[model samples]
Target chain A: MKELDPLLHSQLRLAIVSLLLTVEEADFVWLKEKTEATSGNLSVQLDKLSEAGYISVRKEIVGKKPRTTCSLTPKGRDALNEYVRTLKEYLHI
Target chain B: MKTDELTEKESIELISRMIEKTRNEMNGDDFNSFLAYGYAAVAISIAVWLLTHFTGNDMWCFGWFAMFIPYLLSFFKKGKPEVVTYMDRMMDSVWKVIGSMFGISLLIIVVAGAISGIIDFSMMMPLSIIYAGIGTSITGLIINEKWFVWTPLAGLAAAIWMLTCGWTGGSYDNSWNLLFAASFLIYMVLPAHIVRHKISRS
Candidate 1:
């Protein structure tokens, strides 16, 4: 069984998920810019989230340019909510 | 160990925590400064409008005066970085929408001006400025930023009125230049004071 606490543990992945929660969908460049993470690092983190079935990645052409967009899955949203609830509980806020 | 080595879940959790912490630490000082600058620009513009309306002199002078107050205030009141950063995010989003609309409007004006070569290139500068004021005001309303509703309304109204009067040779009587001036005062200066008070309180 995967631990809920483990899902709440990493910083870069946490940033990516939090940003995706606010925006409907974000492009790779946008997420990279907002999080100030390098391309290689963000790519690795995104793959991990995709593997966990927490996010969906789509590649499409925008203005004749190939773009990759990432959106939070239902599972991602639920996991995020649970993580937030637990954090609040821990902080007693 | 490395900053870049966090797991996916761990990354998500860490960012969530950072945002939460950042929001908790937010104070009203930065918001206050933003409002202050906004209002001061507005108030001064309104005062200029009244002066130009009654005295029948050049309104553009007053308009320029009104626009300068916010720039001055921003220079003086440099607040905390966190609050500033948050406010920047909020305002930048607001401004971006306004900017996009303003760009569209400018395209309209440019096409119109080009077709009617009677309108000089120099005129585009003032027209763009006035349209930007109007765009920002409307954007404010859309975003529920009540502090910004007045300046653009005043500007748009003034612009429409001036354009109409110029075309028909009505009350303004070809004094479209003065009306543009008056619009700036009403739109830019008048709102500045209101924004300033709102910011100071918050």
Candidate 2:
């Protein structure tokens, strides 16, 4: 059996990536709320994904507040699809 | 959901749950803008019709100027979430195109009527009603809302009724305005309120 992508195998990181798949983009607050993750923890996972080139994060000022928007990169999409494919294969379904 | 290692079934389940949750969030929007515009459109149409009837002056058509209130109010509102989904962007684009079509069509009809000196300005109402039906129906289709789909049909029927009455009675201004008012109320306002109520409940 082939090994899973360790970077995407974690629960929170996988959930974040999964959520991004359905939308054009999501802000930090939305991600935090949906994942029910603490701001600090979500920030850390986002950074790790950013470093791995799985997602792109943009910081901009909307009104007076700094807004952080995250989108799933093409690489990230391909990884997710491939992960699902491999997992399906493992399950023999 | 934090886990050191997920089995194959668990991974599939997690992915499915995440996708489902995200989709629900994307669709979970209150129809604030729709409700505002629907109510305003209904009110303006009826008010203009009543003023025209009571005053016996054609100038009451200018009451349509009030319809801009709800349209412009939408811009000043800040309820839009920072995050937008694919469906959100698509719905926004749909409404924008529909709005532009109405603006351009109205401008063309008015300009043609004025320059040719042969077209009746009152004729614009039926055409506008038809366009409203088309727009509402298209929106209904895009959103998968059957109520919206039927609204356009009802609007078109009202427009047809207005045309028939004008042909038979020689003057159908009141009927035209009344039908439009009813259409806006039934297809736009009522459905918007129902959708908003459902959104709140969900």
Candidate 3:
């Protein structure tokens, strides 16, 4: 049996990647609002995905506040596609 | 969502729901932009219609210049790329293309009308309405909005009817302007309200 990609196996990480897939990029606040995740928790998960090369995180100063934006990397997109393809097999849909 | 371990089915469901959420939030200000343009179109068209009616002058036709104001405001009002979704970008591209095509067509009609003398300033009114319909139809297709697709057809039909009837009603000069106003009302204003309602509900 093929196993799910470990990086995307977690719920929050998966949701983050899914959300980022639909948009060009997303800010920390926007992702936090969409996933309804605590700031600290979302930050940690985002870091894990960043380390896994699933997403790129950019930190910059914007209008007197530090802002973080996340975007799906090409590797991350492929992983997502493969993950979905595997899931379809498991679900037999 | 609980960041705990998820089953295959649970993970799939989560992904699906999150994607839906993203789509809903994509065009956050589109409805507002639509409403602004809708009201502007109706207002400017009506004012010009009345002006032409009273003064017997086609110079009021320049009022169409006001239509681009709403579009300019919309461009400035757009959210940053980090916040704008792929769908929003697609919608923006669609409108940009439509606007460009309309502008080119308008220039052609105006210059041609001036040279030929057969196509006057007043004739441009109905033609513009028909072009508006074409734009609406294209927008509808891009957004998968069925009503938008059909709405423009009605405008085109009315414009054609007015043209063929040769201003069947009272003032022939003002008839096209009235048609333009009516199309803006039915297509733009009414759709704007419906979009507002949907946005509110969502």
After TM-score superposition, what is the CA distance of residue A23 in candidate 2 from its true location, in Å?
2.3
> Candidate 2's residue-wise lDDT over B19-62, tens digit each?
99887876666766667777777787788888888889867877
Sorted on TM-score, best first, the list reads: 2, 3, 1
Weakest lDDT window of 10 consecutive positions for candidate 3 chain A: A60-69
lDDT of 1 by residue, B1-202 (tens): 1234454445445666656644433333233433454455445545555666678664343354344455566556533231223344565676667557556765776788789884333333345446567655754565456646665666566666655654575543324444555554555444555554665676
**Stretches > 4 Å off in candidate 2:** A51-53, B1-5, B110-114, B117-123, B162-172, B197-202
Best by lDDT: 2
Name model 1 segments beyond 4 Å from true. Answer: A9-79, A82-93, B1-20, B24-117, B120-130, B169-178, B189-193
- Model 2 chain A: weakest 10-residue lDDT segment is A1-10
* Candidate 3 residue-wise lDDT, A21-63, digit = tens: 9888889999999889999999999999999999999999876
TM-score (chain B) of candidate 2: 0.83
lDDT of 1: 0.59
Which window of ten consecutive residues has the lowest lDDT sum in model 3 chain B? B166-175
Interface alpha-carbon RMSD, every candidate: 8.3, 1.7, 1.8
